[model samples]
Target chain A: MLSKKQARAFFLGGTLVTFLIFIGLTIFSLSKDVDQTNHENITEAVVRGKDLWDHNNCMGCHTLLGEGGYYAPELTKVIDRRGRPYIKAVLMSKVPWQPNGRKMVAYGFTNEQAEDLIAFFDWIDDIDLNGFDRVVSPLAKDKTN
Target chain B: MTLYKGKRRTTTALVLSMGLFFAALLYLPGMLPFDSQVTDSFFRWWVVHLWVEGVWELIMGGILSFLLIKLTGVDREVIEKWLYVIVGLTFLSGVLGTGHHYYYIGVNKIWLIVGGIFSALEPLAFLAMALFAVNMYRKGEKKHPNKLALYWTLGAAIVSFVGAGLLGFAHTLPQTNLYTHGTLVTAMHGHLAFWGAYAMIVLAIISYAMPNMTGRKLYDTGRGRMAFWFSNVGMVGMTVAFGVAGVAQVYMERIMKIEFMKVQEMMEIHFYILIICATLFTTGILMYIADFIKHGQPTDEALIKE
Candidate 1:
C-alpha cells in the first residue's frame, strides 16, 4: 500500500503525463500530412489589390468570418455566396450609398479597387477554417462572425 | 480555504459564462447561413461585441485584479478602481460601438459615423489601461524584489496596447475602414489582439497562480521566458504575414478586377509564413505545458501551508 503523499504524487503525476501525451498527440496528428505550402507572397496585381483595400480600409465596413469592426456583412463565404461576377459588378456599380430605402448601403469602390477587393475576398475564401468558430469584431463596421 | 474557495468559485463562474457565450456566438451563425440578411448579421455582431469587448474583458480585468493584488500586495481599493474604470468604459464603448456595425445591417449612414467614432474610443481606452498597467509594473519592479509576475503583466499591457490598440486603430478611421474591411490585415489585428492582449494575460495568470494553488513550483523561470519569446515572436510573424497577405489579396481582388478565385490562388504564397508562425505558436504552447508539468519537485520549505 502506498503512503498518502506518494498516492497524491502518483495521481498528479499521472494526470500531468496523460495531459502532455494528449497534447503531443494532437499536435502531431494535426501536423502530419500538413499541406506544407507557403502563401506569404503574391504578384504585383494582388499586392496592388491589397494596397487599395488598405488605402480604403474595407475591413472597417465588412467582416471576414465574423471578425473585424462590425459595420459590414460577413465576407468569410462571400465568394461562396455571391460568386465572382456579381461581386465585381456590385463593386463597380459606383453606388457609394444605398439612397434611403435599400437594406444595404453601397460603398463606392473604384473599378480597379472593386476588382482588388474581390481578389482579396477570393484570397480568404480558400482558407479551411476546419469548422472553427466565427467570432466578429465589435469594432468591425457591419459584420457578423 | 474559505477565502480561496470563494474566489475560485467566482473565477470558475466567470470562465463558464465566457465559454457559454463563445459557444453561442460561434455556433448559432451557421444555422442560418442561407438567410444572410442584414438583420441576421446584426444578431451575430451583438454576440461578437458583447463577448470580445464586453464580458470577457471584464473577466480579464477581474483576473488581472486578482494577480495585481497577489503580486503587489496593493490595497484592493486601487485594484478595484482600475477594474471599475476599465470594465465600465469597455461596456459603455462596446455597446455603443454596436452602432458602427449597425450601419451595414439596414441602418442609416449617420449611425455608421456614430459607431465609427464611438468604436474608435475602444482602442483608446485599451491603450490607457495598457499604459497604466505598464507604469505600475515599472514602478513595482524598481521598488520590489518578489515582483516576478510584473514582467508578464507589463508584457501583456505593452502588446495589448501596441498590437491591439494601435494597430487596430490604424485602419479603424472611417475613411480608412472603407477598403480594408475584410482583408488579412484585419486578420492580423484579430490574431494579435485576441492572443496578445487577452490570451497572453490569461495564460500568464494561470502560470503565476497555478504554482500557488497547487503547492508546487514546477514551472521554471527559464522555461517561462522561452515560452514567452516563442509565443510573442510567433504572434508577430503570423500578424505580419497575414497583414501583408491581406493587402495582396485586396489589391488583387479590388484593384485588379481579377476574379476572386484567381486572387485566392495568387494569395496562396503567404501560406508558408502563416504555417511557420502557427508551428512556432504550437511549439510555444507545448513548451508552456511542459513548464507546467515539469514545474515538478516542490521546494522543501512550505510545500504545504500550515
Candidate 2:
C-alpha cells in the first residue's frame, strides 16, 4: 500500500520529469534543422491573410492544417485543389457562397484582400505535412494532372 | 492575509493556478506569426492539448477528491492519496501523449512512436479514477443522503473513462488518426469527452452544492432524476449519430476519394439526427435550470455549522 507521502512524491516527481522532457522535445522539434515549415516565405500579404482568417473566425466552419471545425472543407491544400480564381470569386462575392446547401458567410473582400488570402493559402499549400497533405482527403492533393 | 488555508484548500488553489498558467500560454502561439506553421501549431498544442490532458486533469482530481470526501464520507487521507496517484498517472502518460497531435503536423517521426504509446496509456488514469470513485462509494460507511450527487459523480467518472479514455484511444493511433484526423470523427470524440469529463463534473458539484446552500432538498424530485437520464441518453444518441456520420465520411471522402461537398450532402441525414438529440439534451438542461430556480437563492440560514 502506497503511503500518502509517497503518493505526493510520485505526483511531484512524475510531473517534473515529464514536463522537462516535453520542453526538451519542443525545443528539438522547433530547431532550425527540424523545421518543415517554409518560414522564410511569409510575406506581409500572408500575415494579413492570417489576420483575416483569425478575425473572421473562419475556423468556426473551416479547418486549417486538419485543425478546426469540420463543418467546412479543410483549407490546408486549398490553393492546389481549387484555383486562385475560384477562391477569389468565393471571397469577393457579395452574396453567401452556398455550396452543397451549406452557406459560407459573405465577406465580400476587396480584390487586394482576396489576393492576400490567396497568398496565405499558397503558402499553406507548400508546407511539408509529414504526408498528411497526401493522406488527407484526396481533394487535398493537387489536381493539376 | 492568511492565504494559506488548509492543505486541501492550498492544493486546490495551486492546481487551478496551474490550469490558469497553461491557459495564459495560449497567447504564445498568437504572438508567433503563423509563418512558422509547425512551431505555431506545436505551441498551440502546449495550450490546447496540455490544458485538457495535463493541468485540467489535476483540477479534476482535486474536485473528485473533494466530492468523494463529501459524498462518501471517505477519509480525506485515503482519498487524497489516491488523488495524488491518479494525477501522477495522468502526467506520466498525458505529457508525452501530446505527441499524438504532433504526428501529422510536420514534426519528427519520434512523435509517432512516443504519442502512440503514451496516449494509449492515458486511459489508465481515467480507469483509476473510475475505480477510485466506485471503491470509495463501497467503502463509505456514511451515505450522505444526496443520491443525485452520487449519480452525477459516478457518472462523471465512468462516462469520462468511456468518452475521454476509450474513444480517445480509438483514434489516437497514428494510422487511424491519419484517416480520421480532421473529419467529423474528431467532432464525435470532442463532444462526448468534454461533456463527460468537464461538464459532468461541474454538474455533479452543482447538484451536490445546491441543496446544502439553499436549504432545499430537491435532490429526490422526479425532474432532477429525469434531467440526469434525459441528458445522458440524448448525449449518447448524439455521439452515435456523429460516429455513424464520421465513419461514412472516412469511407467516402478519405478512402473512396469522393468529392468533399458531395459526401457532406449525403450525410445530411445524420445532422438531422444530431439536431433531434440536441433538442432532447437542451430540454434536460432547461429542466435542470428550472429546478435550480425553484431552489431559490442561498441564505445564511443554510450554512453548515462546523
lDDT of 2 at B160: 88
The DockQ assigned to candidate 1 is 0.03
Candidate 2 RMSD to the real structure: 2.6
What TM-score results for chain B in every one of the models?
Answer: 0.81, 0.92
- Compare the candidates by DockQ and give the number of the best one: 2
Candidate 2, CAPRI quality class derived from DockQ: medium
Over the stretch B1-306, how does candidate 2's per-residue lDDT look in tens digits?
A: 122554445454555555656657654654655455567678788777887888788767777777888999988878888888998999999999999999887778788888999999999999999999999999999888898889889999988898899889989999899889889888788888888889889889899998876877756778989899889999988998999999999999888988789999999999999999999998888888888886757656555521
Count of backbone clashes for each model? Answer: 68, 0
Listed models, DockQ each: 0.03, 0.71
- For model 1, residues B180-234, the per-residue Cα lDDT tens digits are 5555667778888888668888786876776766675434477677787898898
Quote the positional error of residue B278 for candidate 1 in Å: 1.9
